[model samples]
Target: MTRAEIFKEMEEMFGLVPSMFKSIPDATLELEWSLFKQVQLAPGEIPAKYRELMGVAISAITKCRYCAFFHTEMAKLNGATPAEIEEAVHYAKSSAGWSAYVNGMQIDFEQFKREITQVCQHVRLARESMGPGDMSE
Candidate 1:
């Protein structure tokens, strides 16, 4: 679509054309809008609530206050609880902390990958061995 056509569509869909869309260069507007629609605005395999939560987590990590605010509201609108939103932020922080530590320590990538795979396999096997009502002992 031409830039004008995309802007018109965006205005119709959103009731107003956001500055973010306007800021995209005309040459790349079509591709950028296509990706934004497909990934951010559209529902896919992942539900909207989860995707919004992820957006919140990433925005928090990136320290993008605008995105964090926008996505937090979007997540709530999509049925995420306040507790769930907070938990997602905590999860992001924990992951970032561990990532910093591991990378700082210069852990061997091959060894880390092998250990992670082994741990996953162990968990899968243990879960498979359990009956439907069985709790791990």
Candidate 2:
């Protein structure tokens, strides 16, 4: 993907283009790429750990090695211990087959989302205090 192509897509998504986008082409797989872009930017409705757990579960179920690795990293970033992450995957394996898992999952999701939202708000507040960015909006 040419740098121009990536910047163009980033510009469209967040008003300002991120230079990192230039490392990949957005048009080559627009459909999947767009979905990925949305997922990356969409607000989380659960704790980052929970989201990472879900990602791991989904990846395991879907047998996506790349996603498994990615979510593992995310889980670690969210301060999840390796044992906890492994437990999350085990829980997913045990219950993901049931249709009622959504409700159970939603419980965790809501909590995670709330926590993340609070953190974001706090960060915005801190950023406001420092006047490093226009976080008031």
Candidate 3:
């Protein structure tokens, strides 16, 4: 789509053409906007609320205050609670910390992957053996 066409659609959908779209390079604006709409605004298997929450976590880890705030607001619009946003940020911190430790220590990648596989297999087996709502060993 041409930049003009994209801007028309954006205006129709958002009631105004956002400055962000106008600021992008003209050559790739259509592609970028298409991708953003498909991934961020469209219905998908991941669902928008969860995706927004994930965006918040990723934004937090990547130190993008703009994305963090945008995604947090979108998450709320998509039904995420304050508790969920807090937990997402907390999980992102924990994950980033663990990744930093492992990468810094130069842990074996193959062993880590194998351990993760084993853990998943064990958890699947345990879940299969247990009845619904049964978490006790």
Q: Which one wins on lDDT?
A: 3
Candidate order (lDDT): 3, 1, 2
lDDT of 2 by residue, 61-90 (tens): 788998898888878877888888888788
Q: How far is candidate 3 from the true structure (C-alpha RMSD, Å)?
A: 2.0
C-alpha lDDT of all candidate models, in order: 0.93, 0.72, 0.94
Which portions of model 3 show Cα errors greater than 4 Å?
none
Q: Which pairs, if any, clash in model 1?
A: none
TM-score for predicted model 1 compared with the true structure: 0.86
Off by over 4 Å in 2: 1-34, 96-137
Better of 1 and 3 by lDDT: 3
Candidate 1 vs candidate 2: the TM-score winner is 1
**Model 3 lDDT per residue over 45-99, tens place:** 9989999999999999999998998999999999999999999999999999999
**16 in model 1: Cα distance from truth in Å?**
1.1
- Each prediction's total of clashing residue pairs, residues at least 3 apart in sequence or on different chains, is 0, 4, 0
Q: Which ten residues in a row have the lowest lDDT in candidate 3?
A: 128-137
**lDDT of candidate 1 over 1-137, digit per residue (tens):** 99889999998998989898888998899999999899888989999999999999999899999999989999999999999999999999999999999999999999999999998899888888998657554
* Root-mean-square deviation per candidate: 2.3, 13.4, 2.0
- lDDT of model 3, residue 103: 100
Off by over 4 Å in 1: 133-137
Candidate 2 or 3, higher lDDT? 3
